[model samples]
Target: MTAPDLEQRADHIVEQIDRFVADGKRVVLSSSFQTQSLPLLHLVSRSRGVTVYFLDTGYHFPETLEFRDQVTEQLGLDVVSLHSATTKAAQVGPHGHLLFAEDPDYCCYLNKTAPMETVAAASDIWISGVRRDQSETRRQLDEFVVRSDGTTRYHPMLDWTEPMIADYQERHDLPRHPLDDRGYVSIGCAPCTRNIPGSDRGGRWFGMEKTECGLHVDLVR
Candidate 1:
C-alpha cells in the first residue's frame, strides 16, 4: 500500500472509533507495548477518552514494563494496568511448580484471560493490535468481531504488515521496545518468549502447541 492508502485506512479506523464514542460506546484498547503495537497505539491516541489496558501478567520482562511506561508517558494515554485476582505466589500446580511450567493455559487464564474478560464484559468495544500476518490463528481473524458476551473486538491493525509497522514507526519516530533490538520481535511474558528468526510469533510459547495466551480465544468464549 502507498502512503495515501495507509493514511486513508488509518482515517477510516479513526472515523469508526469516533462514531463508537459518539454513540456512547465504551471503547477500550489492550496493548502489549511491543514495537508492532505502536501503530495501533498511535492510531488510538488520535481519539480522546479511550483507556488503554495492559495486562500485567507478573511474568513480563523488566524491559517490557519500562517500554510500557515510556510509551504511556510519550503518548499521553489514559492507561490502566490489569492484574490477576490470584496472586503470583498462588499460581502453583500439583507438583509445586509454577503453573506456566505444568499448565500454560491455566497460567494464562489466571494471569491474562480472566482479567481481560472482565474488561470485555464491561466495555462496548475492545481494540487490540493483533495483525493477520503475525500468526496462523490471527490470519483467520476479522477486522471486527462481536464476542459471545456482546462486546466488539476491533483489530484496526489486522491488515498491517511488518513493513507497514516499520514505516509508521519511522514516520512518527515512535520508540521501540528495548528487547526488539535483541530479536524479541513479538514480546510477551519472558518465560514463554524467545528470539526466533524470520517469524513474528515463532518465539512465543517456544515449544508448546499453544500460540495465544487465551485473551484472543478464551476471553471471548
Candidate 2:
C-alpha cells in the first residue's frame, strides 16, 4: 500500500517495472544495507519480482554482515551475494591488510564495482537505492540512464530527501542499520568509515577527494 496509486515520492521505479524486470528480469537491488536503501528493499520484497544483490567487498563492517542476514530473514528476500574474483593476498598485502591506503580507486574497483559488474550483467537495469542527498555525484544522477558498461542504471530513490527516507522506514517498521544511531548514515568499508556527530557521512573519505566507489567512475571516461 506504500505506492498503491504511485506518487512522486515513489521515484517512478515501480511504474517502470518493464525496464527493471523482464521475463526473468535479473533485476538486482544493489544495496549496502544503508538506511537510505531500507525503504527500497521493503518495496522490492513486497513486489515479488526483483532479486536483491549484495557485493561482499570483504571490508564491510561486522555489524553490516549481521544486519545483512537479519534483513534477508525478516524481509524474506532472496539475496544474491557477489564477490570479487580475487583473494585476500591479491587485494591486501602479504600481511593481509587492505591496500586502500595506497590505491583507493583500484581497491574499490576490485571490491565494490568489479563484483557488481559480474553479477549485474544478468540484466540491463540495476536498481540502486541511491539518493542525491548522499553525495555530490548522486545529485546529478538521473532516474534512469545507461552506464559506461552498456548497463542501464536505475536510481529509484534519486529524488528522496534523507528525512523522507527516515520517515517512511519508521512508518513501515523497517529495520534501521544497527549502526545508524552511531552517526553512520552513509556506511561503507569498515576501515574507511567512522562516526561523525549528527552526520550522514558527509565526512566519508574525508581526507581524500573521493566520495564515490568507482561504481560510475566512467563520468570522466
Best lDDT among the predictions, by candidate number? 1
Q: Mark the 10 consecutive residues where model 1 has the least summed lDDT.
A: 212-221
Model 2 RMSD to the real structure? 3.1
TM-score to native of every candidate shown: 0.96, 0.87
**Which numbered prediction scores highest in TM-score against the true structure?**
1
Clashing pairs in 1: none
Model 1 has an lDDT value of 0.88
Candidate 2 lDDT by residue in tens digits, 1-221 = 24443344553555565444555555677888876778888777766677788888888888999999999999999887788888767777545567787677788888888888786675766888777786677777787777666777777778777777777777778888888877675788877776775666665676787878877545322
lDDT for 44 (candidate 1): 88
After superposition, the stretches of candidate 2 with alpha carbons farther than 4 Å from their true spots are 1-8, 18-24, 93-97, 219-221
Query: Model 1, residue 73: displacement in angstroms?
Result: 0.8
